[model samples]
Target: MKLLFLLKEGFAGFRRARLAVTIALATITLSLALLGLFGLVAQNLSDSFQRVFYQIRLEVFVDPSLSESDFQTLKSEIERIEAVQSAEYISPGAALQEFEKDFGKDLVAVLESNPLPPSFRVLLKTGHSRPEAIQAVVRRIEALKAVDEVVYPENLIRLLDKYFLLGILIAVGLGTAIFAISTLLIFNTIRLAIHSRQRVIEIMRLVGATDAFIKAPFIFEGILQGLIGGLLAAGLLWLAGDLVRYLFLPGLSVPWLYLAGLVAVGVLLGCIGSYLSVGKYLNA
Candidate 1:
């Protein structure tokens, strides 16, 4: 009965201070939405890159003029390496055929012969995705007498490493800033709400109400406010996902679990902020 009465009073207080509550909720929702969007995008980019890199094999171009014995020896040596998943010899004719498949024309018609060189296409295990590892492999392959040239996007690997580092730094900085801002906003809102009912709190204390009884309503108010704000933010995030799917990232899908986690975090922040702010006043 006492709890119900306290809840009713809390509802009345929330009604009386609807404008401030609405503003605070709106701020929280927007901040959470931005944070969620950035996190999802970063995660999706990482997953996409990993998937592409894992399936990609290093193209090791073998020397065209090497003797048959040297070619056999080179293939045998390359296959012995643990990092080398599978190394296969692609003949000049095969390379030309592949080119024709892509270009839809016989380059031989213009050049009189397949000017393309026979090569060893090497596939590496997932562990060898790093530029250093790829460089080491390229050096070993180039050292072989049969290998004329080796080429893989060495610069691209370095660029990816730099980009990944930058992305992590930016994400951490933005998340911290948004979290601090949201915490401050919620704290101030709770403080203002308490300030408005200072007289009522005093009356309750005078009437022999315990600190728990006095603080319960404020705690509930915070939880209710947070739940509403979180739901709104989640709804907006879903809408944004739909818009992105329609306009930009139709093929690159961000996981639903990530969006769900964002809403859960939003709710927790709201409840915790309200509890901390009200607890301070209750102690006072």
Candidate 2:
């Protein structure tokens, strides 16, 4: 009987503060939609970066003086490294041929001899692809007597690492700001709703109503508000994403996880906002 009354009051709170609830729901919808859009952008950019990372390979230039048998042995030794996925030997002739294809000119005609060293084009395991991991691999290769040089885009890797971290920090800062704003908006609205029932709440408290009992209805109302706002926000974000994607990029993929998460965020925020408001009355 008490549970039923709390449930009834929970749903009734929305009716009691219909205007405030409507405004709060709209605010939550806009906030969550923006957050969802940001999440989608972040996810796609991360995917694109991983694709580029997969293309990065370590080029190990070997000492040209080594015998063909010794070179083959060296290649085999490199292949044994744990980080090395595969090491393909690029013979001097093969390198020259590849160069000529790119330049469309015979290098032999321009130079007295083929100066390109025999090298190994090594693909690394995915685990060893980070800027720090690749550095260890470079040190390992450089330690070898057969290797003259280990050529890779060290600067590019460092730049990417720096910028990637910066991007995450910026995103987190922005997301937090948006979250705080949304939280406060809902909190204020819930506070106002509860304020309207101060007399009833005081009477309930005097009649031996536990704090939990008094708080339940407000919590339920806030959660309901959040749920509706979340659904609206998720739908708005999806529609905006779909429309903009079709116009700007023909193949913009929708991440369902992000969309679902946005709705969850909305519900969570609503619950939190309600609790925050009720705490004021209970001094909790």
Candidate 3:
């Protein structure tokens, strides 16, 4: 029952069943690594969606022939809309300049004259990026005099929004399922490992061994397995993140803090698995 004796027993058990312990740890590492990658991607995608949502604009191009007073009136009307964030007017020349910047100077030179129209780029408030909401605002703008076109890339935005939502749901569901299965696998592995030494456990139980005395070594062994698994999973995830970033997104490597957080989560899962499995057998 002493701490030193318990530690020695745990170490002896680990030494006696190194193969099974190693296998369980390796399986936990692989499974946790997959889960961590899924978590990282879901978090990043949600963040990207938020940033894009804030940046989306509902453009209202105006008739270039409108007088200064008419333009001012139109701008005022747009500003009064509930979902309007801010509005900026782009003159025909400015529109042409923006196009030139995108296409190149030679392309701009080929144009006989600037064909781009003056427009008002309207940034929307949060939650106003939905198609129906944008359409309502667009309709209101179109009804005003001297407005030529109202553009918001409605179809593209809707598709992106839908896909983002779908991706997030799928990722979350898959991650959860994988984690559950991994926990069971690791738990059973430890249970079987302990079961292989039933003679030792039964002997201890018969010779005035308290339940805690018998369970201590197994619990310690579980903790050791969990720590090793968490570390391996964390390392693999970090490496995979680098490979993915290099292959696809040049500046997109996993953040160190996020990786560390994932490892911590893995450790928790491992402990929970081990505790449950060992506890059940101990009770039995």
Candidate 4:
């Protein structure tokens, strides 16, 4: 069986059964699209978790009445803690200015004096953002002499570190289920194509057609359907990504390699599904 003949026969299969081919392609596109969506969300969730894990910082406010030397000593002690990565002193004036910049209002104009205490902007090492970890660190910091308060995003980190981890597990389970369902759908769709052309397949087999010769066209048919489905799914995903970027997260981006991988997976699922269905006839 020449490549050209296989190509011709594979395409002819479509002309013989347009509706079946269309159904197979539609299933492939939908399955691959859903798989791609699940993958995209999982990646974003992981990225957000990592950003919070390494970027979190705690604000350690000291008594504003402390001498400049005492403030320096406080920072030195904080930097020496087991979990502390670094601590930088933020003067009362600097803290006030930063608050003004964030709030877009001048406290000096509203109140006669800056109320912000001089503090240390403290960064923690990795694996220290969990609620328990942060609590221990806070207790230690507050115990230090002259420290007023240890401020951080306690609620936000708790939700992200604890709850988001649970969410990732659920996402993984859901993704696995979706992949199974999609594979089953493709298998069923390819089986239908085989059943519809059972007579033609039997006739070719009787005429001394080698199983490979008979299967070539069907294999190519599956690949063709998968390729078409992949293209359609990719197009839809790209459009959706664009809409999401414009509507909510202006910085959101889908990696190009991941998009390419989705297409490759589509083609792979097509070939696998086709092979499984076509194998049944070879045994018969």
Per-candidate TM-scores read: 0.73, 0.67, 0.78, 0.82
Question: After best superposition, candidate 4 residue 132: deviation in angstroms?
Answer: 2.0
Candidate order (TM-score):
4, 3, 1, 2
Off by over 4 Å in 2: 54-81, 86-122, 130-158, 206-208, 250-253
Model 2: weakest 10-residue lDDT segment is: 47-56
Task: List clash counts for every candidate, in order.
Answer: 1, 0, 0, 0
Return the clash pairs for model 1, or none: 63-148
All models: lDDT? 0.76, 0.81, 0.77, 0.86
Cα lDDT for residue 201, model 1? 76
In the range 62-170, model 1's lDDT, one tens digit per residue, is 7788888877888889877778988888889999999999989989999998899888888888868877787888888788776778877667677776686687788
Q: What TM-score does prediction 4 earn?
A: 0.82
lDDT against true structure, model 1: 0.76
Judge candidate 1 at residue 235 and give its lDDT.
83
- TM-score for candidate 1, please give it: 0.73
Candidate 4 residue 59 C-alpha distance from true site, Å: 2.1
lDDT of 3 by residue, 1-284 (tens): 49999889877877898887777777778777777777777777767767666457877888889987888888899989888888888888888778778976744467777778889999888878777877888888889888888887777778876786777678778878977777777777777777777788778878988887888778887777777777887888788778888898675647888877766766676566656766676677
